[model samples]
Target: MSDANNQTKAAPKHSAMHIAVGLLARRDYSRQQIQLKLQQKQYDADEIETTLDHCQQSGYLDDARFAALLLKSHISKGHGVNKIRQSMQQKGLSRALIEQVLLDSECDWFEVAKLKAQKKYGEAVPLDHPTRAKCIRYLMGQGFDYEQANYALAVEVD
Candidate 1:
């Protein structure tokens, strides 16, 4: 590449609306994530704000829908309730809504963890301290807490 081309100071000029649609069409993201991405792309601040406002009003940027989708995806992947909640929170879902949706789903939170543990470690179970600790850490990294991790491990390990 020419030095002039490399040295160019012009930032990207992606159409704000187009970028929003393209991003949404590909996958869901928290509103803040989207805003940050726009800023990172060097979009004019006012344009970015206006585009987000318009998109939100048009129902193209819905936090609740995004949270629900994330929750469902994580659960289907055999995640526990605690793990799912933490993931949603990390993705910027409101705590109240996360709890409400989790409750409404009627998902057996503990059971989900138990099933996941059983699948990974087998019916033979891993009850020993070292093995159980490993299992607990795995669950926590997947977003579960110590309690949920222990509970789930116990179901299979005990």
Candidate 2:
């Protein structure tokens, strides 16, 4: 059993389209992400590019749709816009696609901040300076800017 486990074997080669399809069947992927994954699997550059173009043409890959889904999922997790934007950028989404997703989302940052703050600190504003600063810091850590964090911390109960 030990000898069998230590045996060396070659990775079976797969066609680029086959690998790309298998990957897409598992989950949505941006074209660049898929290209990188195929590259890691040792696919040829020309094959990877050709397969990617075919997938895009056939609607199996869409960066815009991927971006939208990513944005929605992140927003639902209470993340701020800046954080979501950074995440998308890291995922290799273009600026135009990212901006389009944000514009289409039409989220109210202040309202989301207020809701998130309430979930954490309740409806009342923090009484002391340290606690107040902590609240602000927490929101900022969640990818909010100073203005948004302050607004979240300043929310008052009706």
Candidate 3:
């Protein structure tokens, strides 16, 4: 019947809180990320706000925790501080919060660069100028600064 077909086609209604909890149940999400997802789902503004506040108060949504987790993941992947910071920013974390998390992490950018270089180029430093430059560029592309990249290649800069 047309009525049965229409009922079947109608989407099930879900409260913003329900949707948010469902999302968080799978993985942690930044407050802003949740807001965007709820907005995309056409949730009412007030409903979205209420849901976000409840999630935050319930310790389900935390930007800091999200940022920290992202940082740890990036570090494990051999990403430099700059790349990690950029990633957190892209995830909608506040600049202050990103800086605080990075500061608290106490990660050594130089060590990460060196390890990445070692993994990519082996233990011996590249002897040829072009090869060395390529290694430096590669490190920089991975988010290391010039100084860090040079350090990773064991190049001394005056």
Report lDDT (Cα) of residue 84, candidate 2: 91
Q: Estimate each model's TM-score.
A: 0.77, 0.89, 0.93
The digit string of per-residue lDDT tens for model 1 on 98-126 reads 88888778877677777777788876667
What RMSD does each model have against the real structure?
A: 4.0, 3.5, 2.5
lDDT of each: 0.81, 0.88, 0.92
Q: What residue runs in model 2 are displaced by over 4 Å at the alpha carbon?
A: 1-11
Measured with C-alpha atoms, the lDDT of residue 57 in candidate 3 is 96
Q: What tens-digit string does per-residue lDDT give for candidate 3 at 1-158?
A: 99999999999989999999999999998899999999999999999999999999999998988998999999999998888888888889999999999899988999999999999988888989998999998998898999999999994557
Best-fitting candidate, scored by lDDT: 3
- What lDDT, from 0 to 1, does candidate 2 have? 0.88
Which digits, one per residue and each the tens of the lDDT, describe model 2 over residues 98-154? 999999999988778777888988878887999999999999878788898888887
Give me the overall lDDT of model 1.
0.81
The residue pairs that clash in candidate 3, if any, are none
The runs of at least 3 residues in candidate 1 whose Cα sits more than 4 Å from the true structure, single-residue gaps closed, are 1-12, 155-158
